[model samples]
Target: MSTLIAGTPLAGRVAVVTGASSGIGEATAERFAELGAKVALLARRKDRLEDVAERITSKGGIALALPTDVTDRAAVRAAAERISVELGNVDLVFANAGVQLISEIGDLKTEDWDAQIDLNIKGVMNTIQAFVGSLEAAGTDGRPADLITTSSIAATRVLEKFQVYSGTKAYISHITRLLRTELGRKNVRVSTVEPGMVNTELPDHVTDPDASKLMADLIHQIDVLQSADVAETVSFVAALPKHVNLTELTILPTAQII
Candidate 1:
């Protein structure tokens, strides 16, 4: 079989993925590299970031591993400067750094709620703040620019214990809609990918025993979507024609009712 399909579809493009250490972020970074985009990975895990970058480089793909805590604006901005100097203008950004801490509203796991708010909501805002300038510049240069955010079906679905997590994701979904109104005028595509029950480490973080069992049972009951599945959708969005924008997509496993 021919490797990498036809010509490099994303040749000369620059992609930045937050939470690029694992799951959807890592998969999408590798996919972007496969299509010839110079990729920059930003996340808190230094070791894992290096591992992803090493694998991509081994396959003759260019990748930059920038260990960053997305909640830290200064750190994110510093990393953005490095990306601009090393990878050129970043036209593609995936604000995918997030955590799912599910618990009942009355239980009041305030710490868990804070963690979700910091990483899922504030982190996304920081990423957009760092990259929007470059994305706008790319648009001015008549190039395709895209900003994609990873949300979850929990955003809309009425789950019992996913109060804070759902709220955070809903923030992401709506923010993407609002961002598109402004960035879209500049020809920078802004979209959100809302996946339903993806088989990712996110489920492992739920400390609520009831919620954990519910998630475990759901995973066992169906073939949950994998990280690669979501990555493919994200890459497809970025690879479309410059004028085409797939605004909001909800990806669900065939067996998943929601």
Candidate 2:
């Protein structure tokens, strides 16, 4: 009797994950590598990317660290080119590089707003733009590609002091929907992964006292989500058959309520 499981489902596939330095991005890259995919790790932090790549290579998985700032279009394109040369055509891409700047409506912090918009919105665009051509080409060659974006549950649900961050995520959420419509015919799958209350350094970047307090309260109230949980979801989605496309996935802690 043969088992109905295939090991290394992503064997021969190349995956690119932005924001690979830590948290969800790091976990996704490691998960992809574990599943036998050659992973390209992209982030602004060279040391962190190198560390993640070292762990992957040490575990007998292929990984390449390409330090990049997703907000820069040229840097993202160059990183994509390097991935093409080193890992072959990318079969999967996780546009997960993002930052959260939480402030109340009256705070009037234009810099925080700009930071969130640039990294969360433009960064996502740069990643998608840099890889869409390759993904489409891969499809034409009979290999369907997957594009997954890391959104936030805040996009759909209201969260205090998350106004700008939520708006940016919502933008990407709709953009992902549009991409799915545009790329479906070409056999490229586009999806968004929205998570809630993940215990990551994301909240640490918040400067608003009220927002920080809210984050702390949320963490104390519910079972916090983990980077591994999101990573598992990403791997599961990526491992599915090419014909299956999970358009949007919202992952939340069981104890959390909208």
Please tell me which predicted candidate would have the highest lDDT against the true structure.
1
Model 2 lDDT at residue 52: 100
lDDT (Cα, tens digit) per residue for candidate 2, span 1-258: 122224788888999999999999998898889888999999999999999999999999999999999999999999999999989999899999999988778979999999999999999889988998989988778785899999999898877778999999999899988988889889998999999889889999998898898778989988888898898888888888888999899998888776
Q: At residue 181, what lDDT does model 1 achieve?
A: 86
Query: Residue 22 in model 1: shift from native, Å?
Result: 0.9
lDDT for each residue of candidate 1 in 123-153, tens digit (9 for 90 to 100): 9999999999999999888999999999999
Off by over 4 Å in 1: 1-6
TM per candidate: 0.96, 0.95
Best by TM-score: 1
What shift in Å separates residue 249 of candidate 2 from its native position after superposition?
0.6
